[model samples]
Target: MKRSVIPREFFCRYTPEVASDLVGCRLVRVIRGRRISGIVVETEAYRGPKDPASHAYRGKTSRNGVMFGPPGHAYVYFTMGMHFCLNVTTEPTGTPGAVLLRAIEPEEGIAVMVKNRGPIAVDRLASGPGNLTKALGIGKELDGEDLVMSDRIFLEHGRMAREIGTSPRVGVSAGRSTRWRFFERGNRFVSRGRPSSPQNP
Candidate 1:
């Protein structure tokens, strides 16, 4: 498949707006000579210091400094000491904000994803953040990488999601009342099933 990368300016918008708009867009990863791709299906927004659920809420640190960098960069981070999750920086430089790429519908390189995840059902190949990263071979090494120009991984233009659902973010202890999670409604590949509300036409 051809890759038409999204430009840097696209991510300079508000975190939640970017997160909602990301659904159905293509995330591509080029590993060696192979191409692995998927359609983004679910995302959660983090709005810098004011949002308690955000890693940058407490303030910037060596681990989270990337969140303060310019938009359109990868913010891959380790979670639970066992899994990696992928996020894209949002807003502008000096302001920390991001969108967590929660789920994806695998589009290419199924064999590699299956090999990495081991005999999982096809629908669940990249159904969650950790799983998505594993499927695409994304890890800490790609942290702070520019997604707009990175040869390893980048986002491409895909059809915008027509029906979008919003809800309180999952797996976060704080900011539980904030409806920052966005996903494609009725998409079986979405990371979670319950939609607290509907947003976008």
Candidate 2:
């Protein structure tokens, strides 16, 4: 199949829209000349300043400066001193917004994903943000990389989810009422996590 990279314009909108629309898109990463990819299954939007759960909520730092840069770029960050999470920058230039890629359904390069992630169930290989990055061999090196024009990593058009579900973002205390988490309903590859508080109707 001919794969078309998602344009930068696609991410130059509201952060929540980009997060929701990213579901079912393909995230491709090239490692050692091999392509490892999967269909995006879950995401969470973070609007800077307004979103208390966002890294850019306070202001831009050396680590989060990329989020204040142009859209369609990768914003990778280390968390808990162990895991690296992958997020795609959203909104227009100078706007601090991003969509955290929560999970993905493994598509191509299963063996490589298995190797990268160790012996795990196919569905679990990329079922969480950290795991998804590990499975695709993504790390701090790809931070701030241009997803729209980069050959090493990029997004592609894929099968859209038939049913998308929404909920409050997991592990966040402040944005409990905001339903910014989006996932493909009934997708086995989607991560399993509940919000810190009840979601508002």
Compared with the true structure, what per-residue lDDT tens digits does model 2 show for residues 71-156? 99999999989899999999989999999998999888999999988998998999888888888888899999999999999999
Number of clashes found in candidate 2: 0
Clashing pairs in 1: none
What Cα-based lDDT does every candidate model obtain?
0.90, 0.90
- After superposing candidate 1, which stretches have Cα over 4 Å from the reference? 1-3, 193-201
| Candidate 1 lDDT trough over 10 residues, lowest sum | 192-201
lDDT per residue (tens digit) for residues 1-201 in model 1: 765799989999999999999998999999888989988999999987789999999999999999999999999999998899999999989999999999998888999999989998989999989889988888899999999989899999878786988888888889998999989988888865335533332
Top lDDT prediction, candidate number = 2
For candidate 2, the per-residue lDDT at 140 reads 97
The residue pairs found clashing in candidate 2 are none
